[model samples]
Target: MINLYPVLKPFLMAVEPEAAHRAALGLLKSGLAPRYRHDDAALRCEVFGHVFANPLGLAAGFDKDAEVIAPMLRMGFGFVEAGTVTPLAQEGNPAPRLFRDVKNKSIINRLGFPGRGLEYFVAQVSDFRVAQGAGAAADGMLGINIGINKETASAFEDYSRCLSALAPMADYIVVNVSSPNTPGLRDLQSENMLDALLAGLMAVLNSLDIPPVARPVLLLKVAPDLTSDQRAAVAQLALRHHIGGLVVSNTTVARPEMLAPHLREEAGGLSGALLKDHACAVLGDFYRLTDGRLPLIGVGGISSAEDAWQRIRAGASLVQVYTGLIYEGPALVPDILRGLTARVRAAGMAHISEAVGADIDLAAPRAEAAA
Candidate 1:
């Protein structure tokens, strides 16, 4: 399709970042977002018992309240993850929470979880599903990401309640314990807390009224900031609880030295090109830690197909992007998939999955020089 992001970037950049975000969503919901259909065989892949048209997805935070999911899917993402929704609606931090670092092609956001909450989110998805019919659901998957309210009395209980309330509408339920904007939220990633959280969520899944055939897949979204021991602990806990998958990372609290001086100091999660290496390393670590048995959806940098392919080779079964969309526009999806198809062909593989982790060692870290 025509690339409009470049022509629109100057205008988009002039607006406040958060307002620009909402404006873009407005365009999407208004039936004005770019749309393209890609039926290339090489891009098709499957995981978590579902067939994905491609392995690339629109990560959480971009469509936080389930708005524009169908429009986003039509833009060619294999799936779209919506929300970091809490039990009740929250305004999140204050204004000037989302900042863009144009030079570094990154974003630092302390927007917290400014969303309409579970009741509205679930209703929107339920209504959208019915309006679109089977064609929409068959077109792409919708992954619902849930988190706790900033002031909730019990984080674990909020997660269970949200999952229980939204399971029927969710293709998958993501337990978000790693967003740094929520105070003490990242602390939920601690071994004991995460173990208890996942166990409780699994129990919620078992207790859901939905039939087994309609049960949503369970996945964990984690932060890139973790020590080796912590990563191993989280991986083990995930396997122990039979979690369906893991979104290899959220965004990092660590600021890269190279980020522009003005943008580096923002007190929120850092994402985009600045995040590429660290996110891949974390994905590789989890891949090796789990021996590639656990499916991972890598997110963080991923601005191009090379980035996506590298993460897959490092061990991500699927990948997601958000900041890349801001920088590269709607054309990014088809571009990456096209390049990925070429890479798969060059590697002499019939399918993209065949190349996953092919260049990495399970016992050691792959050096930067190796790639």
Candidate 2:
């Protein structure tokens, strides 16, 4: 394990962010990406009815079309969430939609879930499933992240269609209604809309010919910017609907004063280092609001072991990373896991779960009183 990113970052970063992303994925798909090994068992986590070898996962945007899943898993991720796959193929936002704030180690992108249509997506995962059964990386948990097509008038229809076709192959399914890139997408996160969307998707799952035990776990990806009322309401809805878990956040639309002016001007969701505090605060809020009843997968701003440990203590059962990889490279995963193990041992916890929400006082002050 040589950390190749330092040597590669200059060339990679010099290219347009989006192209560099594609190139990185291509390298990964071609088995040319660097690999790291982690034998630590302390970081194992059980969430959403599946056991993850570790809490770290590759977030959805990195492999939007389900490519490089095995490569990613082999690289030592406990799991890989694939797609914000829509009902139809989409071009997403125009070129230059992705921007890097090297100074702040953040990214702003309005990539509106551009992906090959569900049919193609299914074909790819179907191949993966088949290969998995035939001695591929069976230990790797695969989650399918579903979303509505940009032009779809009925969000429910698009979600239902995606679930009906892809759920059987997914260990869990994420209904992504929080992306800010698509117009009106965040509207679905509203209490009424979110409930309807989730309920409809669940009904579709239930109606399937498969046994109840066979249905994939359903999770929701929410915005980081939700108000307190919204957080509580969504938490209630998630519990009411028996949603399996929540991906604590998508990216943020708000630009902090810390961002460089040029990067701040970009119009899209912001992710990376800048998102750490905001993402953890939201995770802590949801953990408290849900009363620790619901499992949470924390995403955003986690670039190191300490960051992952903080989120775990803040109440995320598992954590994910995307932009951090853009900055820190694959070695980040091993480093995080090592750090988590150290933290767990230092905290006198045998398992990482014992650390979940261990520091409620340290969590961001509640949006309303009483954190």
Candidate 3:
């Protein structure tokens, strides 16, 4: 094994950004094909009501159709989440919709929510995971990230329909109220809107109520653009209605300090190192406000193990990455898991949860209170 990544970077990054991503995913799928991913790294941890080999995972949008999910899991993620799949398949915004910021190690994507419809993705994904068995990569937790159509008024219904269909085959379900590309989707984060959306969706989930064995988790993903007040409101609301928990802070619409380039004019969400602070702030607010009452899954500009640690301490029980995987490639997985273990040891904690919120509000007594 030759890591041709160094040789491939300049040429790949030199091309159109979205093309580069397609190329990279093609390579990852072929190089670490589904059948060969079992032994890359044994990085497991327990989260989302199941056991994960490690806290590292590929975020939604990476495997839009769920075609390569098994390979992503095999590639060494403690787990993997796929899709923002709608009731109908859409082509997404338009090509040239994804861009790379070489200097910041970031990616700007307005790809919209392109993917095959819920039924198609669910059929394939269900059969795929069930094929994994009692002890296999498929045995590791599998989360289905669901969203509504870009042009649908039935937003709430769409989420339920998808969840009801996919939940049977899923280990967890994420209610994606945050992707910046979708119009009014982020609005669902408002307390009133979120309450109804979750209430309706939960009604559907409740109808499917299978007792004894664990039901697929229902997670709410929020935007990074939310104000401090909104962050607290989200946690409070989740607790109020008992939404499965929260996936704090999705790709941000805000741009941090940047390179002097025309790409700055590109519309869409920016993710990667630039997103770290806003995400941490949101997570910290949620931690302090919720007192870690609601389980949190962190997603924002995560590019390294240290970043994972930051989110964990800020109150995330687990973390997900998308942009970092684009810039750094699949090798980034094991690197993050190894780094997480090292950081966990440095903090003198036996389990990762002990480190959750370890640094956030540390001076406030409660942050250090968890540790």
Error of 3 at 332 (Å): 1.3
Model 3 lDDT, residue 293, Cα: 73
* Candidate 3 lDDT tens digits, 249-304: 78888766673276678899888878877787777777777876777788888898
lDDT of 2: 0.87
Tens digits of per-residue lDDT for model 1, 1-371: 77788888888899999888888988888887787777878778888888889999999999889988889888888899999888999999988898888989999999999989988998888877886685653378889999989898899889988998888888888999899999999998999988888888898899878988789889999889988788889989989999998898898999889998987677999999999999998888888777889889999899999999998998899999999999999999899988898999999989999977776777665343222
Candidate 2 vs candidate 3: the TM-score winner is 2
Candidate 1: clashing pairs of residues = none
Which parts of model 3 are misplaced by more than 4 Å? 31-44, 134-138, 362-371
**Residue-by-residue lDDT tens digits, candidate 2, 1-371:** 76888889899999998889888988988888667667766777788777789889999989999988888887888999999899999899888899889999999999899998898999989888888889965468999999988898788888889999998899999999889988898998898988888788888888888766667899999999998888989999999999999998899998999998977678899999998899998998888888788989999999999899899888899999999988998888788878888888998889998888776653445654332
* Superior by lDDT: candidate 1 or candidate 3: 1
Clashes of each: 0, 2, 8
lDDT of each: 0.88, 0.87, 0.77
- Candidate 1 vs 3: which has more TM-score: 1
**Cα TM-score of candidate 3:** 0.91
